[model samples]
Target: MKIKSYFQFTNEQRRGVLSLLLLIVIIQLSYFYWSSSKSTSPSNSNKSWLAMQSVIDSLKISQSSSEGKIYPFNPNFITDYKGYQLGMSLTEINKLFEFRKQNKYVNSALEFQQVTGVSDSLLLAISPYFKFPDWVNQPKKAFSSFDKNTYENKKSIIRKDINEATQDDLIKIYGIGPALSERILKQKDVLGGFVTMEQMESIWGLSPEVIENLNKYFQVTTIPTVNKIDINNLSVKELAKFPYFNYTIAKEIVTYRSMNNGIHSIEDLTKIKGMPNEKIKIIALYLEF
Candidate 1:
């Protein structure tokens, strides 16, 4: 009877318990509905994002194809990086470099092929872009009669002392322009004058072909006298003022000089730690013991 009393509830209490059970069932149904909705929303979002990504990839492909189109460029000026982009091997590039070292140039695409020994397919592909100087492409004028003395006189008149060459003179060279001519003059001013033809290499943007032309027409007939540096006596700061040396190298040189009592010659300077062996000869030109 006591157990039966525990199982039984008052009418109001029974009503309250039924209401609580209904509230819990409603909450559970709402939770399940929202969970299923959230799951479906992500799947739809993923499908939309995938479609957008495919469109973006297609746009990138088209853009890359347009950008990858090669433009016409001078084949003679091709650097290793440029050659690599054009599918040239290291051997072909070296052959071009070797030919250029001899102060020779390939005036035509056919000549370029002969010198570099590039495959015919590569030659055909790149020849269209080979932009040689105007003089190289211009037809040679033929004279009906040849005069030996007149030809010699004209050749003599054509060549000039490089030290006295003005900007006007420099611009007359096929490859050199007003800007390059001005730069050459400016470098000449800074160094007081060029000591050697090799000094032309220091000028920025001077190509091998341009230098060859420069050599053909101009020569250092009179080398300018430079104020020589007293290498053994100068302080690190003073030594650093020399064009070939920087502060670190200057300091090392001074330290070496101190340790050895004094540096005697270019040979002594070369023995110093961190000294550039090849540059010592050039540096020797401006230094006294």
Candidate 2:
């Protein structure tokens, strides 16, 4: 019997194997052509990415512009930081500070301009939102809700010591209500007591009209004794806390005191390097020597 060899292939099987090999070679050639056509050249992709980045940058700019919108605020209370943010020049800011250092308030837009000397364009930009105290622009209707006891309690109205008066007592006066009464009491605490009714003019929201009412109804009969700071004894830090004394002036006062043995009078303080000459008279009210 003739044995079949295990390694030998029949004609049909050999043809099938050859056909399969031909198909694989044809597939590989097509794949090469397809890959060549679709290779990654990223010019268009890069352009799209750059265009997206530009849009994102524009959005950031727009967001920043929106954030710059100014709101209504009191111009009198602008601090150094606020002035800088509002684009005020150093000279203009200094002018405002000098005005405020005298304990005067900016009552109107025209007054603010005169005090700060801001440019006309800048003033137009910011002045629209410059809100002063309520009673300044629109004086409130007089307190019509006065109880019969308000007049009946005769002695209380004659001379209610401003420092001793409670909020209830303060509201009895016309043009004074809850808010104004609290402000008066709070300022009284900070100042120890009102020396002059003029001091009430410095309160944050009190208008001239309201101050007049307060003066009409109440008197600072008992000037609360304060521990007056002796300029010769106070350090620069202590002296600078007073409204009239700034850091530079206070430091100069201390230095001048040390140099000349001690400051003898207000004139000596005014002679200090940075001290305002006119400020000495009012500053003397808070200082002993």
TM-score of each: 0.53, 0.52
lDDT of 1 by residue, 1-289 (tens): 9989998999999999999999999999999999999887777779899889989999999998887467777776789998998889999999999988886668788898899999999988878887765445645446557798878866776567787999999998867877789888987775567777777776765777779879888888877876678888899999887667789999998898889998898789888887767766766777788
**TM-score of model 2 (CA atoms):** 0.52
Q: Please list the residue runs of candidate 1 whose C-alpha ends up more than 4 Å from where it truly belongs after superposition.
A: 1-10, 25-63, 66-85, 88-105, 131-166, 179-183, 196-283, 287-289
Per-residue lDDT over 1-289 for candidate 2, one digit per residue giving the tens place of the 0 to 100 score: 2355765789998999999999999999999998886675556888799779989999999999989788899998898888988989999999988998987888888889899999889888899988865457655576667787877775465766777889998887766778788887876765566676667765667766677878877787866775467888988898888765679888898888899999988778767897766545645676787
lDDT for 249 (candidate 2) = 84
Worst 10 residues of 2 by lDDT: 276-285
Clashing pairs in 1: none
Q: Which model scores highest in TM-score?
A: 1
